[model samples]
Target chain A: MMKILLLLISFPVFAQDFTGCGEYKFKGILKYDEKAPLKMSYLVREGTGSQMTFSLVNKSDVITLAPFIDKPSQFKAKIVKLMDGTKGELRTPMEIGLRFPDPMSASDTGIEKIKSVKCQ
Target chain B: MKATKPFVLPIFLLCLSFSVGHAAEGSKQFYFLGGGGEPEGETTIFDGEVKRVGSFINSSGWNSTVSFNGGHSKTEDLIKSKMGKAKNAGTFSEKNYNDLMNEIIQKLEKGELKSGDQLLISIDTHGAKRSAGKDAEKTHRVALAHSTATELNNLSGARTVDLDKLEKIINLAAEKNVKLGILDFSCYSGNLLNLHNDKVCLISASGPEQYSYATTAVSLGFFTFSYPITFGSKFFDNMKKGKSLEELFIDSRTTGDTPDFPMINTKEGLAINEMMYRFLTPYLNYNYSSTNNFSAGYVRRGDKFEEQVCRMESSHSDFLKLLKQMEEAAAVANESGREEFQNLREALEEYRKYQRGYEETLRQKFDVEKEIKDIFKKQFPNDQKAWEAYAPLDFLSLNLDSSITYYEGLAERDKGKKYFSGMWDSTVAQLKKQKEISEYVKANLSQNGLDKLKAQDEAFAKSGVTYKLSSRISAEAKKVYEALYNKNKSAESNPCRDFVL
Candidate 1:
């Protein structure tokens, strides 16, 4: 029983998916109905296995994401409302698109993708 | 129907058996009515109402205080001279108004506003209706005094006591287990109903499009002058008989004219009936003394239904222990004492009644919680996303999408499509709250970690796709809820026995 438990612990779980670790600049429109996008910056913290945290600046929002057991390389982040200050409203539909920094390329920051990788 | 099978009966039973207890001896009723501008405007009406309502409640044997800008006459001259603004503005300086509201909140936080108290606040002042845009309307607010620049450039600054600040004050009162009743006698005051919550009753002097009427004849607004004058005596009579605020509103008498149709939102049919009665009745007790009564249980705001449930259980357990101790003391006192025995007997009686009221209110709240769960189960029987999103519906204020989603589902199920559709339409008018919550989260969640996370998620997304993440988010929410509710249970086991009488 002990050996089996050890084996199970050692086994690589195929379920865990993308790991979007490290700081990234995230931008998204607060209101989906409206065309204007509110640009926000975030610090991304990726944990050992499946958890990832995103701390948004300016808006002072923090979000955590978890990978689905069935969906490979795809993580889910909660739907949150963002404020549209220009309209004097805090309820804007928010979506975050993250990009890593790249000093060499003026337009090309590191890929806009969450670095998808297998569980260790 | 099949979807409701698993949760329907169990949730109903849970609600039926649910009751939470709050034990606090000092219940102080606070009344803050400020019509910033008095002489130039019909703020004298505010002054009259203050005296009428204050004296009326006091005469009914309740400890009450009335705070307003009675001395604003001197301050007004100083502010106008300092800013070179209009002399007839009649409102207090913005700083003074903010300071008054802040003082009230500070006292409440300091336990001046205890559990089982009533907070009746009315603000009668000049108002302004500012549009965020063409699409957004009806965020009406009380206009305070203004700076010279603000007055010259834009008069919107006068609308300082906006919906968000008012909502914060009401939420604080609710947190203290205090019943909240607000009356706004300003232009477009009907929009003030956006502050409505459980245990809260709001009355606005005018509808969204109308202006509150102030007649020179009475030196006051019609609603302010009419409500207490026409119904003050009867309202107090019914109140003594344990009538709830909603009942008082429904049975209230009105005279003269209904030019500015008053709007009220009680969130009726919830546990508020018992909550308000319990909070207000103590004021009616002729023997009521702030220093004598002893409080035994605890009241803390919980973030989730499960946490609230556990807290209720613990509180009830503590209440039972207190009762047992009192009974033993009463038995010993017959042989050994007189005053202690009488005090014990009185404490037991008052506590039992208060405990019963608390439990009833808790059960009532659970009924609503159960209904929300039932609606979720019936609407999205197999959908995980819907279940997770709606789980928080029982805890926090319902966001627009969730409300519309629930109502639409109800419309689908019920044979009376007309009624449900109308309900859905009325909810659509309240989409402005979505904005209010968004701003509140941004301002309040800057410090706490978990709260910040929850606040961020509350920011409504552009579409339904974002809600898919709720399936994962629900687990974290449940853990946080459990931690919050269980944090104080360790101290509950040892009964509180230090009160002098």
Candidate 2:
């Protein structure tokens, strides 16, 4: 009964649309720990004409993404956490992946997933 | 017909003697005004200047006439009261402006005035470079008050006066024995110095390659406003004492720490005597608390940025070349050169740091340009021409920022021996000041009820700001970038060529 009350308290605090079910996987030039992997959640917000904004939160950095052109679902974000940062966008499907055109770095490719949650 | 021919000969001979006879008399002053800005929205600064100059000539009891192409009725009345009827027009069209100039030339050609009588011709307008034929150099033309670029394109019916036409007029005046003194208050006015002869004297606001700034803040050109301020009550008094126009030009100090180098070019062997006028005190009568230092600041910053970038590139190349030479010498030296070789290697390592910094600058430039273009595209999605119009200014902003960042890094790397940090600091400050003025001008345009597109078009059309950025700044950028490329090419082509071993 006490654990159920704790669950209710934490449920209301989760970011809007961030149900804590999403799992992001690293790929391409960027190396990561295979054992732990990467995880995150995103919330969509209103944007300027034909654009949609997404906020991605993680422990190290919080990235804000929006479409550069008319491709709304393929949201772009600038990664400032790397060597002086880079600009790129992510394409989300069954498993999401990252792409960028920066000449300095080739480490931007990645993937994402959302796992179903079970409650008893 | 025979009788008429003999009479014409006698009449010509008599007029020739009459023209020669008056060569020893005093000078005569005539005023000709061309284009000033809109009269309703702003104070008629040029017309006011005409009134003041007319008042001075009248107060000094000189025989002169003022004929302005367009002036307010009130200013025309003032001129009439002081001198005589000014050639007043409600709107100074190109046809009307050319007509006014023709009238003056005809009067001079017809011997309306005696020889040695000086005609002080002052023109206040915006000047532009008119591209010439493949074999010819580009010449400048001054836009008339109501003239538009559309009119400029219709060359057969263009309103502006080219240097060739102006030179022909000056030649005619000289042939008629009338001394011509020109006070051209416009950008690239110094090009008028080309007409200099024993019979002509010229003074301009800026060199041919430079810009003369105007600010809505002051509502008058800095050079134009400074004219009377520096001359004081001595304006007419000095002229009476026979101070050549060059002296007068030098005396009229530019106001408020102007970076523009106002120039005066006189004919060879002109009289160089210093004559004191009756009036010594100066009064900046129409003082504006705020001033427009935009053009001067912009030119200075652009120049400094180019110099800094070129210097950094040159120094890096020279250092590398020096390293290669030292290595070559060490290869031929005995064991005693070991210590020197160690020192040379250390120096080479230090120079490599600078080389990497310069390389980083190139990369940063690419990044900044990409970011700026993205921002501009996002802002003006539909207008490609606006993108072109604004691209130079945006490019300059990022170029300057990159330069500042590089300089900061260099200063930190060199410890106490910061080579170019001082100049970079001042350049950055000037850039900031110009950005503020640009924003203010942009805001003013919007408030004046011009929609964004219309504002961009009209501002570029009327203000001469189009020429200010696109050509001049881009040319400077190209110069620096080319210098860097050349340095890299030379370094790569002859890598260690001097290392004999």
Candidate 3:
């Protein structure tokens, strides 16, 4: 089971949300929604996601995704509402993307990050 | 719909007999996914409705899938803020939600789903009215949380899950013979009736055209902790103990102050849904707390449904009364603090008005003194006699300025002397009393409502608006007093006082 750590940063007006990285073999990309704006996606060898899947852990605690995430990655790096302080919001339509620094490991990081691997 | 068939009646047609029980070989998978996508909505829900999604979040019986849109996190930070870290929390975004649905679909296709497998996807998010497909029940659109990662898809608009798209995933599950139940807690959630089928049973917070509500008191939407039910039956609490989701919904619908929005009384919870009561809610032994109150629901609850399940036949009558006492004590303390804050605000405003008048009158007096001096000089160039006569008039003018009163007798001499010099020694006294009482209530209150009330009080303290305003007033009042002292001292020696007019 791969555990992905979420490192947080807060928006000026909103609560803090963390970003995490893990190492995964760059499996090939797949189609999620052909019609929606962000349709192309990729897969992590260890995950069960049809397109791609990952799980998040915050600080030292592993909460909420208790069932699905305790095993191999089977969930997406979940998105949160990022507000447009000027307007009302800015939306990130569902799309799967992955990247990692060189030498990513199962200790400091999780698996080989499905990094910079373009969809065929 | 799966190739193999079973002799079971459709779910909507009165659930037939109690065909579902613990005997099922398959596991009951429950996913409590969602919170308002927006930060405002997230804060409103994460504390109440979303937190209660713990029916199986921590349980070993049913497999729980937990995801949240907002908190200090994707997981409910309210728990993290009070307790410590939580377990296996996931994030909520349109992409993630779709992925989850797809995962389920994949599971069913792989024959991973068994005949007895039951899947309950409980959702709570903000909603908006939108035009959906022809076959769609209504235009209820869920405002799904967007990923904060501005990397891939940065569309500048509201984020909504395509109901039509979500419906496709649900229908596929149904076709695969998966028993899919949807419990939607969003405004106009009933539009999910579009998902209605033999394998699916849908429950919503309100009808397609209606709006849902939440309360600071309950920290929940009206549906969960609504007034129509006796003291509001918590849906998940009942689900925790063996009550079915359908039963909990019926209990809330029939008993809520429905057909109308819940009117919150600091003393008593007001009313609930009408059309809902006549239809599916059947009847629970409960009564009205007020008129025009039957059309609403809450995201929170006063009593656990299981506690009342045993109490239904025997001790249901005292349920509201008991809840009322608990609510009243809590309500009064919090309400009093807020009420006093408002009262103090008004009092300060009134005081400022007087201050403006006092300053204006002083300015006018100064003008009069200059005008008199000018007139005397213009009439008699260097005439010392004329200047002396004008001095007595200047003294009288200064007296008049001191005597000026904007609010009847509440003049500067009395006013400045009153709040600043004496009387009303404690500014915002009522607010102070309420705050003190709130501190006491927060310290001594029982476990049931204390945390929430304390949170509110803590938030109030953190805002510090009241104290900030009071301190500003105190500083401004001191300025007024200093001006009055100088005016009085100057009045004592008017230079022409001895030259009586």
The most accurate candidate by lDDT is 2
Identify the runs in model 2 with alpha carbons over 4 angstroms from their true place: A1-120, B1-27, B39-42, B60-63, B69-91, B130-139, B147-159, B213-243, B253-256, B267-308, B311-363, B367-501
Candidate 1 lDDT over residue span B38-73, tens digit each: 334322433433444444454444444433443445
Per-residue accuracy of model 3 over A1-120 as CA lDDT, tens digit each: 121111111111111111222223221222222232222232232221111222221311121111111122222232332212211111111111222211101111122233232221
Give the poorly placed runs of model 3, Cα more than 4 Å off: A1-120, B1-24, B40-42, B71-75, B79-89, B132-139, B146-157, B217-233, B258-501
DockQ of 1: 0.03
Best-first order by DockQ: 1, 2, 3
Leading candidate by DockQ: 1
Error of 3 at B431 (Å): 51
Name the docking class for model 3: incorrect
> Residue B160 in model 1: shift from native, Å?
4.0
Clashing pairs in 1: A80-B459, A81-B459, A81-B460, A93-B461, A93-B462, B37-B90, B45-B220, B143-B158
Q: What is the TM-score of chain B in candidate 1?
A: 0.37
The models' CA-based lDDT, in order, is: 0.36, 0.37, 0.36
Q: Write down the worst ten-residue block by lDDT for model 1 chain B.
A: B492-501
